[model samples]
Target: MIDSDILCDLILANKHKCKGGEVADYIPGLKNANRESFGVCLIDSNREVHCAGDYEEKFTIQSISKPLVLMLAILDNGEDFVFSKIGMEPTGDAFNSIQKLETSNLRKPFNPMINAGAIAVSSMISGASAEEKFNRVLDFIRKISENPTLDYDEEIYLGEKETGNRNRSMAYFMKNDGVIEGDVEEALDVYFRQCSIRVSAQDLARIGLFLANNGVTSSGERVVSEHTTRIVKSLMVTCGMYDGSGEFAVRVGIPAKSGVGGGILSLVPGRMGIGVYGPALDPKGNSIGGYAILEDLSKILSLSIF
Candidate 1:
């Protein structure tokens, strides 16, 4: 049996570790987060929830939205069609680096976990216009997380839109390469809105739980297919942490996706889903304190997939 008391103690013990990292400030709105905030939530297959610290506090979902978006795209367009647009390999470059696309002859984004591929996948979402596509994404997330009230943070969306020159460059490059279809701005709008979806740690945990159970809810309703969930988890293990994926795999030994907003959606396949939030981030944009706490929990609870 998992020890909820120990998990809470671990959170409290590791909360002070936030001093070692800084919050993501590139997206003007993300910089407004409290640097000291930390939270965690864990839900097992039985739907029992264990939480600690500020798990109730809401934050932007950020890049953690990538895997979810990828699943949606695969469901909409099928895997073969989607993979034809983006490569499955992990890029050693930063998530937003445009140089990788320039250096690669294929011009396809490395993986959906990165910004370029995510933008491409967003374009593939079934819709006639940007608004329709974004609404589809919003509905999917709400269904997966079981949170009817979840919505985008318009401030963050506009902030990302205003300061998204790099993303714009990537979209245009992909358009030139024929990797992305439709209007670049429209695709970017869907991407930005999806990333800006606001959720608390508990919401993420619930989403993770769905993934943990192979795309099924606690009530036994199937969301995504088992094949889709398997692919998503495999991608998370290989590329979920951006360039730091290998290190995360070595340390945590579970599939997880981290966001610039300091949220992590992790799962122990068939066991539990975990959500972590620490506004402070490491150089690679992962939650520093949150990572440490997960390491502790994985070790103490033998949660590693390996």
Candidate 2:
């Protein structure tokens, strides 16, 4: 792990990037975030932890939840069923863009990291009811993070539900195309709730550590299969940063997922898991200060897998 003093200095060095960025305003509940807020947590393969800034501040998981839900969906329905509805290729369009869905010959979303594909994947989680389905997703997250009290923010969930016109359009479109099989609202509900789940940067780091450890808990219990972890990390590399994934790879060179809420869940496979939060975002919805911090840390530690 990086030295604590060095970690703190890294955060202070990049904290100024927040001034040039914007907090996500499309979602009403996320608009009030402190624009200057920044934090990071890193947990290495030895179970050592290091943190700086406001690492314990809670925020919604947002799109960062996509890969986690994809894991559960795959566990419930075989990879054949899940991937049949969602393609593995990366998209060049914005994460929420609807253009490619119409252009693709199969009508499937380009990949699970985007909203359209995540919605499709969310519908595949098995349960007797919508509530049961959401509980299962929540349970999976809690188990993986080893945090039993994990929960979502109702205000964020309701706000997302109310303002999610674009997402609704995608869901209805997928429903019409048979990409989604059940009630559209039910599927959207699960997606919304998952996105609204709240966690601190430390919590996100712990989740990333779980992935870094190949889905095995610190106690040696396996929460996800090795094959599934590999697929998830690959997807993170290719699609996790929305259309910015390629640029992020060239710059930071780690598998990561970013949410519009300004949280990033990243891992250096077998080495460490990193969680970053900086509510100020660039045009692409990634945390500006957080990105700077990661880039600096990657260069300093030579953490890039490439």
Candidate 3:
């Protein structure tokens, strides 16, 4: 028996604790977000939803899409094949850092949670063209979230594509190393589009709920295999918060993935799924307010998997 009212009160009590962080400005469009905005949504095993603050606010999914896409890639092409292109280890460097890739003998991205590895995963998604591949991913996301109208934010997608020189370099490097097969631009296009998918806290909570149930929907249909869900959750626990993963695991004690757009999707294994949003980001690009809220909620609810 989870207490929805207590959760709402907790969010209101700690919303101001996130004032120290700044919004992500590197993306240009992400800079337009309201720094004070914060939202949270939680869905329990019984399908009950608890929401607080700006739960209805919409934002881009950003790097949080990595885990979902990683699961999709593994579903399309088994884990063994996907792991061959990207290592499962976390890189202590920044998520977009290419220096690590350049310096490593393996020349592979450290994990699917980072930019290089995600681009490699994007290339593996089955499709004849970039459009087809993107549509497939979009459809998958929509189905999992149970939101048929979910779609990408075109403005954010175009902005990212126009100002994505760093990502372009990563894609080309992976192509040269044979880690990514096919057109670099096409793969990048799919990656950017997936990152640009817009969702409210409710939508993200629904997606998290799907993962929490081991890829099963409330209707009991499995969208992804249990094995794939386990791998994705493990990656989220180990590398989902970029370089801040260790601290998050220590503080929150649950599997979570955060995006630069101030969204985090987290779950308490078989208990519930949580979605959080706050445009104010810590230096590591995680939602400051969102993190605080989750920390408080996890403590109160004893949601730690460990």
Worst 10 contiguous positions by lDDT, candidate 3: 1-10
As a whole number from 0 to 100, the lDDT of residue 252 in candidate 2 is 96
Q: State the lDDT of candidate 3 residue by residue for 243-278, as single tens digits.
A: 999999999999999999999999988888899999
lDDT of 3 at 127: 94
User: Candidate 2: minimum summed lDDT over ten consecutive residues — where?
Assistant: 1-10
lDDT string for model 2 (194-257, tens) is: 9999988998999999999889988899988999999999999999998999999999999999
What lDDT does the true structure give each of the candidates? 0.92, 0.93, 0.91
Candidate number of the best lDDT: 2
lDDT of 2 at 208: 95
User: Model 1, stretches more than 4 Å misplaced?
Assistant: none
TM-scores of all candidate predictions against the true structure? 0.98, 0.99, 0.98
